[model samples]
Target: MAAIDHFWAVIPAGGAGTRLWPLSRSSVPKFLHDLTGGGRTLLQDTRDRLAPLAEDRFVVVTGRPHREAVLGQLPEVAPDLVLAEPAPRDSMAAIGLAAALLERRDPDDAVMGSFPADHVIPDPHGFGEAVRTAVEVARDDWLVTIGIEPTFPSSAFGYVHLGEPVDGHPAARHVQEFVEKPSVAVATDYVATGRYRWNAGMFVVRPTVLLDLLARWHPAFAADLRAIAAAPERLDELWAGLPKIALDHAIAEPAAAAGRVASVPSAFHWEDVGDFDALATLLTGAGSVTVLGDDDLVRPVDASGLVVPAAGRVIAVVGLDDVVVVDTPDALLVTTRARAQDVKQVVEGLKQSGRADLT
Candidate 1:
């Protein structure tokens, strides 16, 4: 298939995946790991999913520590396109930098679709269709996002409220608003209306338009990004002073309220793989216990949930349900699926105890 005209895929791969500790670390994040047992890493899978639509027009923004690793995983992407930030400035600075650079490089009406590097979309075709629609909608000066149909009333994800449809774009709808991660009771009500989608953070818009929108809200921040792009030497000097905030808070939410945002409600199965429980659901079918690593190394007796035997040792579990055991060479994590999100507490404890090496 031919590449989408003026469509550029911007991948922001910077999260440490602290929730998935032992397996995903700051040195090597979850995006760099092969969590799905799919042979390729999550970062690789992200590139593969976008290659059909973007072709060679891809740019990945990551932290300096993982710059080489991002390039190593995505060797097909040109080295120049893999931008490395000197520090962690949250999602806005990371993605905004890509937009700024693309605005200067393309200097044309090219749409940039920002997809986090760690997400999992099983149906690439569905994702592509949504992206295509989003891109077309974006060309009309609307900031578009691919919103995932909620598989369940999930309190862990934010919701995108779908509103009236656009005049010409049947596949798109005006975004009523972007809601915070609601309580399960609130989420259930949202799902009942069939007008809410999980905000997957997939944005499609012209780089200039994105920057222009940023300029409206944060004039100085937008100017700094473009100035760095123009000079290419002031990144280290200017990036530190830029506000560290998520893109959603910086622009998406405000834009939605202003009717500048559109939603392409997608049916594709999307997984953020935020923790072991999520990983367990993604890697295996309906089974009592799901082992992501070597099955022979994991000996489960009357156990339920996930076990990852990555350290090349036998992990035996007995008389447990909804348990998660992740065995690494240096660190071993044992927790229940219900408490998987609390693994970051372990990492925090390690830091406090001066056991940063383990973290």
Candidate 2:
């Protein structure tokens, strides 16, 4: 294995994962759930997958409420590496905090790889190689984002327009533009063109380079983050004033507009697992899920493309195809696989109706 002395990983493990409601709650985020084939929690799998590349230099940036959960899942991670955010301030602040913290350790041209904890990458080896490639590209002082070849017209994900190929690395292309999540038809057009890739939301860049870009592009945010890092005790004060902006909106898109962003085509299979349908796809193709009980036995009876996660609970699905039946102790969710994206609306309705238990 190649030594990754200059490489570090920053995992953002916040977010309630409302899409996976009933099962994923504020107490248990998506990263803590077992939504992968290997049975490892998403956070653990993410850390372990990058172990060969990042070695011991990985930081988990999570909200203060989830500190214990993050630590419990990754006991091997040092206590200092588990940086806790006083509140949720979105990805820009998270990455800024990580860069600020990492700058304190290795200020010199250190490469930091940022990833969300809930994403699933099926091929670890391929993922690591892609990271290595990104690291090399980052050495040139350009922000590098991993772009997944779109297998389908996915409206759930954002897209990156690929410009001309880089002079040296043919696999990586200059980023022409970053498009927000598009409509199904627009996504289909993007897929048909074959010039666009799904934005994986994973990035690699040198700490100094990121700090420089943030300072240049968002000076106020950069100052606030630095102050927050310096005064760790007053994080609450810092977070109170930070804006809720994602890295894509705050950094990547701006950099791309400035012709400073590039992308590497990812070889590994990646899934954001943003909702139940995504999770169902990851949990399928393996062991059969069985829910115990006489009155509520939910098995995949003569049905394909179904997910029954009511383990040990009573669930019975008599005639269902391409359906997701998730039974929780408090609530039950039965929806067609195609309608899984609307699960968030259900959560919203539950919240509006003040049904905390259902959520």
Please tell me which predicted candidate would have the highest lDDT against the true structure: 1
| lDDT for each residue of candidate 2 in 155-240, tens digit (9 for 90 to 100) | 88999999998777776789999999999999999999988999978999987778778888788888888887678887787778
What candidate 1 gets wrong by more than 4 Å, as runs, is none
Give Cα distance to truth, residue 10, candidate 2, Å.
Answer: 0.7
In Å, residue 291's CA in model 2 sits off its true spot by 8.4
Worst 10 residues of 2 by lDDT: 287-296
TM-score of 2: 0.93
Give each model a TM-score: 0.98, 0.93
Off by over 4 Å in 2: 286-305
Root-mean-square deviation of candidate 2: 2.6
Model 1 lDDT per residue over 207-291, tens place: 9989999999999999999999998899999998999999999999999888899999989889999999899878766768898
Quick one: how many clashes does candidate 1 have?
0
**Cα error of candidate 2 at position 316, Å:** 2.1
lDDT for each of the candidates? 0.93, 0.82
